[model samples]
Target chain A: MVKKYTKFIFFLFLIILISSVSYAKPHKQLSDYNFFKDIKNQIPRDETVPYKIANPLFSDYSYKFRFVHMPLNTAAEYSYNNVFNFPIGTTIIKTFAYPIDERDLDKGFQLLETRLLIKNKNGWEPLSYIWNNEQTNAFLKYTGHTFNVSWISNNGQEKYVRYRAPNVNQCKTCHEINNKIQPIGPKGRNMNINFVYPSGEANQIDFWHDRKLLNNIPTPLKRNPAIWDDAKYGINERARSYLDANCAHCHQKGASASNSGFYLNIDENNSSILGIYKTPVAAGRGSGGLKYIIDPGNPADSILLYRMLSTDPGVMMPELSRNLQHEEAIPLIREWISQLK
Target chain B: MKINKKIIYFMVIIFISNFSYGKIIIEPGPNAYDRIQEALILAEPYENIHLSSGYYEIEDGLSLDIDNVTLSGDGLDKTILSFKNQKSGAEGLLVTSNGVTLSDFAVEDTIGDAIVVKKANGIRFLRVRVEWTDGPKSSNGAYGLYPVESKDVLIDSCIAIGASDAGIYVGQSERIKVINSEAKFNVAGIEIENSYFAEVTNNIAHHNTGGILIFDLPNLPQQGGHDILVKNNKVLNNDTPNFAPEGNIVGKTPNGTGIMVMANEKVILEENYISGNATAGILVVSYLDEYEDDNYNPLPNKIFIRNNQLNNNGFEVDKVRAEPIALLTKNKAPEIIWDGVTSFPEWIGLSKQQRLILGPNKTKDRKTDMINLNLMTYALLPWFHKTKEDYDDYIGEGISLTEVNFKTKW
Candidate 1:
């Protein structure tokens, strides 16, 4: 009888094991990928590499952590202007966290969500994970979620934000090119700047080249997009970089908002295509009673500035991932438009 | 303890069974938004998502990217998707997949466009109603059934109201058919912009800024919109003051205008019952703004307006845009008015194929009259201009446009 009982317990254990393993779909749980050595602190595993870009998309003042993990014997193909073609089995991971206090990073942060773009044979598949309330681990959430977060601004003012985590299709809204899902960040021009690695400060391109994560790096990188808030860069370059990061993902040729006829890529130098004296095509109520998209020497009359100042869903530019206006970006864009003539 | 174990086992079995059946029916409750969205995300091709009849309070925008899926609800009034508290995303529901049909539901008070189908072919909207509940306001969403950069679209038995822009807007699309629809109390009841091969038939448009507009703007991804037929539509009483927010091209549409065609090609306005409009029944004009696109043609070409029943129109012209044309016609707007701006020089009026032809218009009380303002002469030299009241020279049997047929069955 004892032997029979032992066999029955073994069978139940086997069934449970199989059931649990089958239920844990690949990327269903954050712990399944083994991307981080420490979840709370966001310490990357040995195979993962951290990277940064020159101009980051504004995400309601959330501090972002970016990392990439490639399989063995595979590397990303470098492109001159666009995002690199990542090989299959490559995973790009981004974590969003709001620092408790903007003045100091030492004061703990509230981790919100982590998004993964996994490169497969079919194409890139996006999966979002919402962090638990106890900040232990994240779980797969196909339908999006919203979180109420509060933080202290740099000026010692308290602010609250209803941070939204986008669903899977919403990920494709900005990360789309030529009717296919693509990575918006990580272009050559946006990643050629110096990054402070754990070892030391080194040019990111050279660092990736040394690590063999990126292939075919041309000597002396030709261009680099400027950081939007950096005062040392030219005003034109800064303004163009801001637009390229924020709007060009959908506004350029063959993208979502291409029907609008306004292209804001960093390389688009044509004044007409850049919306100088250009009339709105389908702006609708987003026009804010303005005429030209960019009126020369008149920032107040420019629709671009007006849209940036709005929080209404119909009127706001970059219609996702941001609810509050980026206060720091307004003055710089205003000055650039004021001196355009 | 034994009963607890048995209950856990039962629940697991139920979960497994549910997954195997592949059936999803969503009802209203807390987290209904996520449940509905999850169903859409996880639905396979050719799956039908049945929404139970209930009022669903949606918080954010919903989207579907799965092809060949049908999202159906109980009925238009039975299943209400209200987005009055939408906080993020520009539109209420966005469909980016091909061969998708959305029917038997209503979306109300969205922050932006109500339903936007983009980059999708073989899309149909049937028995769907999109509206702002409080009535016409400039702060309402721009488009009701908005489809752009798409092809093979059919919108039938739909109703749109209180939109700030066109109630039913199809832009940069091809092969569209909008029939048996009603649009009221919106700016530009139905607008076909930068599109081709559209048939707007058997629709009722009233109490809007302008009834129907076919326009081709410059610098868009698609230009030179052509080969559209606006027939058998009831375009009447569009006398609501233009509540469109400023700086939109539609805001320039004169209030109480029946049909306006601008800078398109081969458009036919035929058999439409147009009456009770305060402006001209049919107004055809060239693009008035300076454009930078070299490939764009700013002149309306080959516009044929015939067999349309026009009555009680142009009694009170829109003071903003159409009053000046009325002043040119003895302070009275006619049944049809053409701006008479051509790409050719004034001496060489127009080739036979590139003319605005109108004739045989059925009138109720007054005589059928039309005029060409010859506004280009006034634009070039204000001192030299003459209005031509005779349109017999521009009358003929115009070329026929092919009817639009869709490949997908809805």
Candidate 2:
């Protein structure tokens, strides 16, 4: 009986030693583990209830996104495989997993849970990704279990970095292609999860419809008294600010365009002097001999569209150091160019 | 803290030294001359006296014996050193010491020479202009720039006009160079006499009685003027309709030569655009009698005249006679015999046989008729009769009336 008890204690000691060693190793290589295998199986096949995101510290945040419906024949008639041609309301919800340092993982999860609120018809709906039997939020299956959230202060004095699902490097590698200037949330090609209701209306769609925040959202019919004020987030201001931050760093005077003599300063109100909205006669960058980058009322012919769609390092947008292609920002830019009549 | 205090003390010493060696400024007033004299007495070597931009009219010439000093002004146009009423026999500014530089000022109507540098070496005149009110023929004033017995001299970006003698006269000087300067409306734009190893390049000698002259005349003790180079100069509009008094003949100095090198050995005249003159573009004659025996003889050697473009835009001969002549009769005694006969050299006229050997007729046939006999006799006769006694004996035979019907073209 004494020998049997001693053997049992030795077994317990062996198990404890193995568990502690596993936990002590750095988590940099943990991404190789299939953490999403079980969660992906729970995602619904129906397009309306496509997926939900969950993490170890949060509950489920229900969301679904899809391409706009089009006639089969009409889709087949278009030869070019461009995703930008889809109807204006088309969207997508992507999901991924990121392994972070254990010390930061707790804070990352807390920040994500606190900021995960959905703006519904009535008001903002406070929500969290549902946690499963493994103590992880179920919504992580659809919107990635890990995410990085960062913001530069309005005055540009400081930058704050927090991780809800992923650390700064893990999220920024794909999201911050042209640095943190690009939107990483899901409303666009960013990390923000887009939640849709059963009636197929986008959450926060009021900013585009009731608030008139978007200038280029086409309406089926004209209604009396516009839904929202026109001053907020007008398409011109949005597109101009976006291009200035993303493209003008190297294109303005004394930068890379020092040889080309083409300056694109965002503050310049004179379109004639800025050389925008006009064909670049001798742009060294090959965008298929395109005369202009922003053709009025015709985004298909613009070279800017070609550049944004290209994954080729020789022809990519921003021309340097961009990782993931900004899928949503490209379409918005295309729509802005299309509406430039 | 100890190291910091030591560094502070070191920096203080450096600052104090710099303050003690700062530039000194000189302002002109009633006591301006007195101040300048005191500065000259106390100036250390490598010091500069910067004169403010103003007019300085002196009753007497200012002389300096300071070495390695510069008397500079704010600018040439603003700094006026007027000696209009000064009766001083010395120059307006005289420097006897070496390494003296004067710049950015003007000297006008000095009673004597405008500037005189004696026994000075490495003297530079930068943008300093000297002029006289009387025309180029005026005998009251002489030697606008007289640098005698000096060495290693440079006269750059300066202008001199209306001198009784040569506008820029460098006598008995060595290793001198004059560049990017102008001598216009003067008796002689530039005259380098008894100078060795000199270069006169990139200058404009225009509208003067005589353009550029390199003469080796006898009478001076210091000889040996050789290896002089005159290149890339524009000598134009020198056919001024005024002569330099009775004995002093002028008006482009005959043959309409833009550059005249009389008795200069090893002289290189290259890449010069000499145009708009009445005579040949370049005249190289050996005036052996003009100089005393001991004076420099710059002749009897190689002279390279190459790449010169000549245009005969000179005035008519009848117009040449209208110029006045100012003869220097002070040292020139009256001739004991005033003979009506004058010897005209055969080389003066364009004979058909002579024209064939002289290559081609550069001047048109009408130019021969325009030759002023009186001016020619005055310029050549005195020296000609003095040198050649047969010129007095058989002078009448040389003056025969001959006409040739050959049409010449310039």
| Most TM-score-accurate candidate | 1
Model 2 RMSD in Å is 35.6
Model 1, which residues run further than 4 Å from truth? Answer: A1-25, B1-23, B346-353
lDDT of 1 by residue, B135-252 (tens): 9899999999999999999999999999999999999999999999999999989999999999999999999989999999998879899999999999999988898889999989
Residue-wise C-alpha lDDT for candidate 2, range B1-410, written one tens digit per residue: 12344444454455455445334688777755446545654565557878888877764456655577787888778787877766322357666667888889888877556887765667888999998767555443456777777787788999998775567878777777888999877767788876787888899988776678876644333455666778788888775534343222232255233676766566666667666655435555544232213334434344554445555543332224322211211221111101111224433654211110011112333211111123334456646522211212211111111111112110
RMSD of each: 6.2, 35.6
C-alpha positional error of residue B236 in candidate 1 after TM-score superposition, expressed in Å: 1.2
Assess each model's interface with DockQ, reporting 2 decimals per model.
0.44, 0.00
What is the overall TM-score of model 1 with all chains considered together? 0.93
Residue A53 miss distance in model 2 (angstroms)? 99
